[model samples]
Target: MNLRKVGSKTNVLMMLFCILFLTSACGSTVSNNATAETAVATSSSEEKTETVKKTEPVKVVWWHSMSGGLGEAVDKLVADFNSSQENVQVEAVFQGTYDESLNKLKAAMDSDSSPALMQVYEIGSRFMIDTDAVTPVQTFIDQEKYDISSLEANILGYYTFDNQLYSMPFNTSNPILYYNKDAFKAAGLDPENPPKTYEELAVAAKALTSEGQTGASFAIYGWFIEQLLANQGVEFINNGNGRTTPATSSLLNSEASVATLTWWKQMLDDKSMMNLGRKTDDTKKAFAAGQIAMTLDSTASLRGIVSSADGKFEVGTGFLPKPEGSSDGGVVVGGASLWIMNNKSQEEQQGAWEFIKFLAEPATQAYWHVNTGYFPITQKAYDEQIVKDNLTAYPQFQTAIDQLHQTKLNLATQGAVMGVFPEARQLTETAIEEVLNDSKSPQEALDDAAKAISSKIEEYNLTVK
Candidate 1:
């Protein structure tokens, strides 16, 4: 068998074993054997003089939504932490996908069985803040007096709510363009040169797409809108603050936003861009299968694409293109962050904080990025000589960092804080489908979306306030 095929099969088997272990262990109950201990103690006092260790370990429960190799990487982190720490024990549970994890977390909150920490996505970040379900991570760090200057400002903005930090930004990711060099060459385009402007990309896409290939696609529809709006200097909501202000309302129907939507609609109309359906999982799989030549997805998708292609594809990564005659704009960060859940004992809270800090350590951050393709959230992590040396070998890893050079803290691009963002995203995606199918013009579709989403947002905001 091919070496890469063997590696793929091995990865699958390892994942299967891990799932089996977790499923069996979660259902099993182990009782303390006081009777057996009593029998053992019945021996001679001299023989029993060997001193037994008798302290219960402090347990910290962490609920997260990482799967496949990323999940394995997290498990490794937990094992390393457990092996090194004598007083605290950490249990990292795979709580399904992002939406599933969020629902499970809310259910846990209601049942008084919530984990000490839970992974939360950007779309739901605001809801997490509104409910007061999460304890502020910055407060914890300040109380413990941990050094945080090394954490980058750009990353801090993503989780900041009302000027106060509420969550530790873990697994942070941003959008980047990934293309296949072989496809570019076949299309008679420069393999090393990617589109710098959206118009240029559209032209290149027309040439690049064929019967079995697509020019470009995106993993997250909301992320694409986020970037497009930023590129066009448009805001999705109105508030000086990011993701924390309940007074903010939707801006999906703005002129710039309408233009962005129009561009996507035109692409679909021309058949130069393919909508391989939504969902990051399906899109990434299609790209790895060589069915698509270019895709814009989370930087974290790098690890999965690399693994799936098994080095068979020549991947070329670049910063997202700016629209013609417009300033290049920022892209909102797309990954989940670790949030501290409420109602835990002080000791457990502190222990959970320690784990969060452990994740922030420069060395640990480097390990995670190298293993999972997530961008480093702290300058200290990337500044490490070791991390820098590793990047020299994998230059594409820096595409996101380069993209950040153009980023600014614009409220529209920083992120939105509406209570029903997930639902809004679904609504926006529906509009995208209508545009792709030519059911309506982009403006018409988005206008309908804006009204629908605004109603829901208002309903949610009212309850939260």
Candidate 2:
């Protein structure tokens, strides 16, 4: 019994030593294995995180003013761009109408949060430049050695200054004469030969007006006034329409502009033309409802007009009529252009440039032109098969293409590039309204408008300087 007890105690002591020594070594091995596994897991996780980061897209914001059908086309183009590449993505934000968009953009500029890309109306070119917050499109074109030889000269001229392209012309349009074929036939006028001059238009309007229908209608917008001046080779503002230097004053009270207003007022007085009072949509509606026989509107309206007149009557388009006895000058380009913001990063700027380049492609231009009725800014777009098919399907669009091709690349046709052009346009609209209301004569109203615009121009120039 004593021997067994001693053996048991010795065995217990031996077991305790073995337990202590093995516990330390085993615990250390287990700790090392756990650390190695965690290291591998972290390394794998980091690799996955980097892979996800690499696959993420660079988002570029595009603030635009397009809405309705035009807006849909813009969305399609953006989607196409996003789907075509894995590196960059474009997000289009509708910023209301052009004027509203410009106002918002001004506010955004102050906060240094302007979009990477923006679509500014042609009249905003000078103002955009005055801000000095835009990266001239020429910079990228030159840097990339991009070939813009296919671009329309007239469209390019509108956005060019100091021998450099400040923006890329995107959705370009020109005002044109839209007439109802049935109305023309009923009035005993040749629908094939639409009005080519204001005099002819007046004659046609006299015949076309009867009963509850007016012969023609147009909004009291200054754009038509500008087109009239440009068609007569009249400068809208001094300093070569602000292309050579900053414009100090406007030529709103020029004889040509005065004559144009007088003619328009007379048409209103004769009851042959409907004065839609600044509401462009009223004119469009009136024309579509067959309340008016002819209307002056942008080529961009072709799609809407045609769709509205689908079964009502046939639609005919022609160049915007010139004043009687005026020589063949040309119509100014009327549309917006794409501008890249200067405050963005280099990668953002490069991404914007890529988008601009993509839009400038002939196929894209053709698609835009066919879908939105905007004039193609590139000649190659006209050569595209889709564009040719569209021209064949709707011969009405051919008129716009022909008219754009006929436009002379001159300062008058290039249009005014004044910093206060938007305000100047408003003044013109107000002057027209005053004349229509018989509150002032055309010359008197235009004189007052010219003075007001001149004052604003002076004030704006001083502030910018």
Candidate 3:
């Protein structure tokens, strides 16, 4: 109160002091606010960096042989897996047909540039195992303590050796008889019941054959021959189909095989069966176009055949016809399995395993089975709604399921596990062609093929040993 009465100079000094004090207080408040803001920004930046690190995905290359609908389904599965987690991304590359893919893989191995994962056919399994270029699926299972109890026993049995799973079974299929229901009905044959024996099939073919249509057609592939041999309880190679030990010889000229080839030759001679040569799609087309009454192909072909038919004619399926009077035999599983390349980094291997595990889940398997006509590798997949709906829509698929369930697991049914199986199959195919073209008798052609396979097996066994 007495400041007013003070001198003008004193008043000015007091006013200056008040202004300086307020300015200093405001500066301190601003500095504290700036420091707090900087701390918050730094914390937010650190959090974002951590998030980026956690979301970084491990990329894996998967070389496969699937094509057509199966290829599309695989791409979908990979996309789903990529979206499911930020930990891994799979690149699915189509490497041509199964045989071509295997050849390419061998070439890649030679260059030491193989993919992180590969899909190898059943025939290529022994060779893949022998090369030691891949890690067993069981290794990862053991490391993760994964429960594989949901896997289908029959499908799993095909890939197991020495009580260990070498590869993850995917897109598994078995051979079955696909026929035109309208053609059967037109020929006065029972469409509801298809042939179950080779002799009966011949009878039906004779009835179904006409001026423009053949009763049956089949690709001159070794797979059906192998299936026939298995159905007759004939092992393709010695040493329990190469399961007990490495095979040194082939049983291509066994009595059962000779009889099967003879029957096939007789069918061709009678003009009841059309030989489509080695191209599988040719036979499939012929059957789908109603030019042939029936064809024998893998269950995997069901989707393609049905799509190709496209309401032109109803399709029917049955178990592959057994040899007359044969017993205690069954069809072997076909299709490919997934293998993890051994030489990749640990992260890549683990990533590949994770992708494979995702594929084996019930939901993925169900989706795959419904989309592509391959049987699911896991039994639980059948319980999924998609699979149930598909089965209801296409009951023909049930024939394959029933056939698989009816199959007796044994050495013959498990198929030949020879390292030279590819060569053996080639020789067998050659033998069939020889007989079909009248170049040689069934026994003569088979005997020659057997001799050649024996040599090949001996060579392969010696080298591997």
Write the residue-wise lDDT of candidate 2 on 1-465 in tens digits. 122323577775654555567677765655565687778889999999999888767779999999988899999999999999988899999999999999999899956568999999998988899899999999998997999998888889989898999999998889989999999999999989999988999999999999989999889999989999999888999998877888888899999988898888888899998887898889999999999999989888888888899999999998888887887678888889999999998889889999998898899998999999898888998889999898888889888888888988888898888888889999999999999999999999999999999999999999998
Clashing pairs in 1: none
TM match of model 1 to true structure = 0.83
Poorest 10 consecutive residues of model 3 by lDDT? 1-10
Q: 1-465, model 3: which lDDT tens digit per residue?
A: 234534698765765565567677765754665687778889999999998887768889999988877788889999999999888899999999988988888888856567899999898899999999889999999997999987988888889999999999988998999999988999999999999999999999999999899999878898888999888778888999989987788888998888888888888889999988998988998988888999999998787887788779899999999887897788899888999998888999999999999999999999999888889998898989999999888889999999998888899998889887888888889999999999999999999999999998888878888
Worst 10 residues of 2 by lDDT: 1-10
Which ranking of candidates, highest TM-score first?
Answer: 3, 2, 1
RMSD of 2: 8.6
Residues 370-446, candidate 1, lDDT per residue (tens digit)? 88888777788887777887678667777778876568766755676666888888888888778877787878988
Each model's C-alpha lDDT? Answer: 0.77, 0.89, 0.88
Clashing residue pairs, backbone N/CA/C < 3 A, model 2: none
If both were scored by lDDT, which would come out higher, candidate 1 or candidate 2?
A: 2
